[model samples]
Target chain A: MLIALLWYLGAVIFTWALGLFLLWRIEKSGVKRWGATGRLFTYK
Target chain B: MQWYIGAMALYAAFLIWTNVKSLKMAESASDFTAGGHRMGLLLGTGTTTATWVSVASVLGIPAFLYSDGAAAIIGWMAGWIFGGALIPIVGYKIRRPANPARTFPEFVRMRYDMFARRSFLQALIGVVMFIGYLFLVNIQATGFGIVFSSITGVDYKVAIFGFLIFIVITNVGGFWSVATTDTLNAAVIAIGCIAAAVTVLLSTGGLGNILDTLAVTTAPINEGGPALDPGVLLTPTGSFGSAALLSIFISNSLGTPSSPHWVARMLAPMNVKVAVLQIMANVVVLLVIWLPLIVMGLGAKALIPSLPEGVATDYVIPLLLQEHTPVLVAALTLVAICAAAVSTGNSMLLTCSTSLYYDVYLNLFGRTVSDRALKNWLRFIVFVVAVIAVVLAIDPLWFLAMGFTYVYGGFGATFSLTVFLGLYWKRMNRAGAYASIIVGFVAFIIATAADVPVPFVVAVSASAVACLIAVYATKPPPLESYEPFFEAEISESTKVAVERVLKLNPAQQSEAVEVRSV
Candidate 1:
């Protein structure tokens, strides 16, 4: 049970962290393609 | 009844308010069709993720897992991963077209440079997309009816009608409203699914207990057949057999890129880089959101080993929430389920409307309707499509996931080769495109009608072969015809030379043009 809990926790954390990192990189690069603003919240 | 009404009322009010704001921003046809191509990565990611995680993912997938086991994950989720990997290739390449198409059918027309203003191919693609959206909308309505009836004891008919009205109203603002509402829906879904998963895991004695229970629970193969080992449910080929599993994988993975709703999301991203990121992020979001539902489904199997005789496996998650979770959590979960339906339904409706207005009415028929008139036509189409979907959804023909799989296979087989080769293979011509679409669609239909065991595989293979043969046998179109795709591939020196020559006086430029023509 503990192992299962640990595994689930590990997977969730890893995915969230990876997603955040990608979001951050996109923001820092400030490179817009097509029309992308690199912003996560705003459409423009 | 009061709770259901109150929840629905609040949801409707929020949607209407948001959509009105979006409508103000959507003054032009471009804004209505493609969110003005201003969708940042965040908004794009949110909308795309929400669109992908339809009611099927929220409910149907879990139901499948509860009845079948972990193998359902491979059948459903594996295809998504494969599809996600292919998205960047096609999405990035197609994003920067010389003349950007508002809809996929329009893209097809522009890419192929078809002869007739209303080419047969454009009309066929539009009709297929409309039917596909119709099926998707029906799925959402069916899901809404089931959830509402189960929660509030409302008649399925009333619930579906209420949902239809709300969906159509929200979509009145077109792509703007859909994208904004989708972002909100994505957030709600993520939170709701995660919360449900945590509650189920903690309450149901964790993942280990669930797996152990599932290991021993035997399910009957048929009404009179012997009980099969439930352990097989954990395998890639569950009791459904290997052939069915392979078909599910092929249909889900390959057919995804062809889905007009998903393709619409791809078209909204601000840039190629953002488009690629959005695709990657979608995979991650799917993993995050799906894992919880998977655990919940497996937990339900352990907790409720024997459901009421008439109750379907699809109801497992909702029943689990009602039976085990607190009132607030259960209500929120139900809302999330509805949100999933709404987000997907609205996106599908918008795509269908765009295809009809742009591909069929304007381009194919060569209508010169004013922008305002076109917008009104789109809204009217949305209402008509919603009504049709509601009528069909009153008696859904197939199980949610399975129905989706059939449509997905057809679309994937039809468009996969065309989109792939159209972007990458310069030699691919109009004949190849036509052959691929026609042969692929027909092959899928025949295989399905004939009840071929692995119809998707057969359909995709046959379509690919036809496409390749057609491409090789026919002469390639003129270099100018390929310019939109290959221009980006031009060498820097060649580009500079061309620019330098164009900078010359008209006489010199004319001479250069004559030489090039020669």
Candidate 2:
């Protein structure tokens, strides 16, 4: 039960980490592919 | 009963008021359908999260956790979030253009067949999108009817029709109204889920106690639910094997990014940055809501081992609230869940109508419609679609989550590879997209009908293979078709061409026409 519970907890954490990490990939991949202006903090 | 009536009335009134405000805001067809492509961070996140949660999250996932145990944590919760993670990847391409298409099918016509004479692809996309979105509306309406009927003692069919008024009113205002109303739904969902989590914690002491109870208890989750195996409830996959879990996860994760409703959301934000940030907000909010549901589901099993006979696990949350909690908690929870369903139903209803009006009628049929006229006619289209969805949902399905998975799976199987290849691959053409949609959808329908354990996985793999083969066999796609997605900075000539297509009605794009009526 503990192992399975850990798996569930692990999945939740992984979803958060991987989800955020992918967003970072979009941010870091450059201005060429995605046109990200590094302007997440300020709105136009 | 009086509290139920009052709370339900208040919630509906709140939704109607918010929607009415949008009626004045959406004066043009573009504003009505796409919020004029200038949605801010907060509203974008609110509507996307609220729209994505649906009945599947509010009732379906929790019901799955209640009956099927831990497998749902992987099959649905984790799998669905994984799908959401791919949003930014798709968002970057779809939001690249300043003047984006309001609907996914229109985008497909622009991207895939900009120069074809009467594109079969656009027509196919419109028809498929119409049916595809109907599955979602049906699921939402079904869940809404069941939950409404239960808490208020209304007849199931009657309750469903009564709810249609809310859908029509909410959607009649178009994108702005839906966004405003759905933002409110998002807030209520967050509040109710957290409160429900607190109730569960106080009732069962803590996670440790709830887990310990499950370890010892062998009783069924409910009379109609599967008999519990003492050890199974705590397993990561529960009754599912590793292959089964992985297959289901892949299906959910990959398919959602390409689906029309989701792509339309990514297209709604003002720019790539807002689109990116809004999806990030969606991921966080969904996490907040889902974690609490896990606690409540396990706690309910620990607190109430068996419900009355003939009651399905789908009714666990409602029954749990009725038996164990006070009236206010129960009412808030039910209203919150119903809000989740209505938010999704109207969103799908809106998308379904767009498929008909923007994609099928204006594009495929090549109707010369004025922007002002389209703004007025779209509301009638929305009303017609809502009525059809209501008719399909009169008899509710048994498993809300399963119903969701079926539609989502079909969408993923058919569109996942085509959408991805279209965005990234220069060689992708109408032939490739056609092969993928036809082969993948056929394979999916067959696998689903056969009850294959990994239908989406098999279907998508088949789709990919067919797509690759078909693309190479056909001539390479034209420069105009691939420029917007592939080139970081489109060529000057290509920009004029792209803008020309964007300005013309999609129906008129296929051939040269001197008369510009749109």
Candidate 3:
């Protein structure tokens, strides 16, 4: 049970951290490519 | 029971409010179809996840996992991950054109100028999209019927009517309403799936106990049947033969970029970056949620070794929640299932209506309706399609009984090859596009009717060969014909010269120029 719990916890944390990091990288590159006029950072 | 009713009542109220709010904003066909291409990352991510997950993820995956073991994940989840990766490669390029087409058929028509106006190809594509959405609607209705009937003891037929009422109300406002409500639905689904997973995990003594139980439990066989092999369930082959599994994986991953509903999502983002990120978010959410649900499926097997003999496997998730959780938690979980169904249904309905109204009704029929009139026509088409879907759902064809593999395979075979080749390969012409769609579609139908073992692979392979032959046999279109798709920004001289060379009618020339300037 302890191992299972740790595995689940690790998987969830790793997915979130990795996903957020990739998103940040993509957004930074997007802003560089198109600048503020592209509305990459703006919400609606 | 009362908690379930209360939750549904609250959700219905929320749907009604969103409909009213969005109806005010949805004044043009563009807003109704693609939210005027101004959707932000937050809403785009939410809708993308909500649309992709569907009831298939919430209900179908668990059912498969319950019957087959962890191997089901390879066929379904792996396909999703691979398909999500292709979004940047295929979908991003298609969306990057200066004058992005509003619908998939429109995109095809514009990209391949041979069928740009008044062609059978556009109408045929629109019909296929409409039928596909209808199939999706019926699937969502079936999911609703199962959850509603199980929870409230209402007849399944009666429960579907109740579900359809909510779908129609929410979709009356079109894409804006769908996107806003999808954000809320995505949150509900994420939270509810996690909560249910945690509850099941705790009750079943965690993932370790569940895995241990699954390791020993053998599937029961009827008389005169071969004794079941427990080993196959844990491997990638599972009950499906290896060839069939590979075909399913290819179909799911490769076909997704061309599915009309998903293609519509690619059109909703404000820019190419947002589109790419939205798909990334979908992948992450799917990965996080699916693992827990797989665990829950194993946990259910451990807790209830055998369901009642006649009970369908689709009931596994709901039955698990009802057995272990408190009334309120179970009720909330059921709401989440409904949200999954409703979200997908709304998106499919909007896509279907867009295809009908924009691709076929207006474009093919040569209607010069005003913008306001077009919006009204779209709403009416939505209502009409919902009614037909509801009637069909009443007698619901058990399409999913055959597995989602076939459906995704059909879409992928028909559109994937054409869209990918058309965008990347300069030699691709109208003949190739037509041959790919027609041959792929026909091959899929014939193979399915004949019960071929690897229908998807055969269909796609045949289509690819046909496409190659057609491309080589025909003369390539002029270099200027490909200019719009290749260039980031069209020069004034090139636009004027191309428009004159194509000899587009006055209306089309102006519309093309307008899209370019936007």
Candidate 4:
């Protein structure tokens, strides 16, 4: 149970980090051109 | 009963009074719907956070844990990050021009044409969303009944009426009142959820006891998918597996950015940067709320192995709190649960009322209504929606979880698509916007009625296709047809206000400039 619990917590933390990291990498790559189109905030 | 009912009533009265004060401050329809477009960053963030917290976070997430194991929490929380992450970019574009469009529907109308704007398709989409939101509101009301019943031993119907009356006070005050109350509700929820988390952990006799109990009685992870393997967490495809994890990612990322509550939140922020910060605030809140829910859920698993099926799994958290925690701690958690339900209900009722009064009634009947009459009509619409929600809450089968999800996904996809595409694809015409509204809504109705095995995936997939069809089917109108839409309504002097929102840059400024020019 503890292992499963830790795994659950790790997955959430990992996802959050991954999302932020991806956002950073996209910005670093100057790939804001691929974000949601026609709206403001360039990443799409 | 004494603590929960008394505290909730007092809080409800306080919220109504605050909302009324906001109503007194509102001087026009724009002021009513958008809080005079002069909201401070703190209040703006507070309102956005409060409204978006909804039952999904409060009850639904905890319930998911009980049923689907830890994997369910991942899916629910992913939406917050996805939705929040994507919004700043959206906000930076929309806040600049400060055009007169009040609702997502109005944006669709402008980007498409009157046929799409005022068409049956648009209104029908609103109807589906309203029904879904209404069902969600009733479910929250039902939660009130459950909380009240758990403590006081009163009938569920009585609790429903008491809650309905409490919510009605805000209707007269309208959006301003909803915002003020929602901010207060958000505060209450943060404190209550954290407190409940701590107490539930202690009551469960700590991590040692929790694990000992789980070792003895934990159900097999799945019938065929590796029985009782805690290592299911190691493989992405184990018990909960990677498939469930990916589902969470897809649903939250695609679904949340499109929610009406979120879009409304985007509208409330003082500037684009503030809106982006608001999304970050959502991430913070998710962390605070979900951590405890996950712990408590695991505790519930260790303590009570059997919860009745088909009852919304979200109810398990409160049920656990009521039965397992001490009386004092239980009462506080009850308030938190009620606060969660009310937060979403109040926001939904407010948003739905605004849509009916501003988007539908005003669009259709305002031409015949005097200004004074319109104010009365707005108040009336608020009352009507609240009363209908109350009745539905009491009626068995009036509320369903999936109903709300489908409507939210459908309407969100429909209007959000128009707003996103219109801003970027200069070729997305009024014709396409109109078609999207019709097809998006029709697809939603079909999905809602169909008993498909995977309704969420089906509804979203079908809706996306509808949006693309709408976009591609019509030729873009000549540049002249869209010229009026590009103009900025904000005075040049307001550039300082715009500049303060740091997420935006000069190129983004040109986007707003394009909105003004179109």
Off by over 4 Å in 4: A1-44, B114-125, B207-216, B219-249, B308-312, B366-372, B395-404, B444-473, B478-518
* Model 2 residue pairs with clashes: none
What is the C-alpha DockQ of each candidate?
A: 0.13, 0.34, 0.13, 0.11
**How good is the docking of model 1, by CAPRI class?**
incorrect
Q: Tens digits of per-residue lDDT for model 3 on B375-455?
A: 677777877887787677776576342345667778888888777887788788888889999999999889878988777
Error of 1 at B162 (Å): 1.9
Q: Report iRMS values in order.
A: 6.2, 3.8, 6.1, 8.0
Residue-wise C-alpha lDDT for candidate 1, range A2-40, written one tens digit per residue = 333343345444444544454454455564433336565
Per-residue lDDT over B114-213 for candidate 4, one digit per residue giving the tens place of the 0 to 100 score: 3322334345445555765677677777766666666677777776666666567655565667677777777877777777778767877786776566
In model 3 chain B, where is the ten-residue run with the lowest total lDDT?
B509-518
lDDT of 2 by residue, B1-518 (tens): 78877888999889878877778876567777777777888999899989988888778877877766777787787777778777777776777765567788778877888875455677788788888788788888888887788888888888877668778778868888999999999999888888888888888898889888877777776566567777677777776778777776777677778778998898877766677677767777887888888887878888888877877677788777777777888788888888898899888888888778877777656677665677667778878777888888876654787777778888999888777878878888888999999999999999988978889988988988998899899999888777877656778767876677665674333322121110
Supply the global lDDT for candidate 4: 0.57
Candidate 2's TM-score: 0.92
lDDT of 2 at B437: 93
Give the best candidate by DockQ. Answer: 2
For model 1, how does the per-residue alpha-carbon lDDT over B107-162 read when each residue is reduced to its tens digit? Answer: 67656653443566777788888878888889988888788877887787777776
How many clashes in each candidate? 6, 0, 0, 18
Q: Candidate 2: deviation at residue B93, Å?
A: 1.0
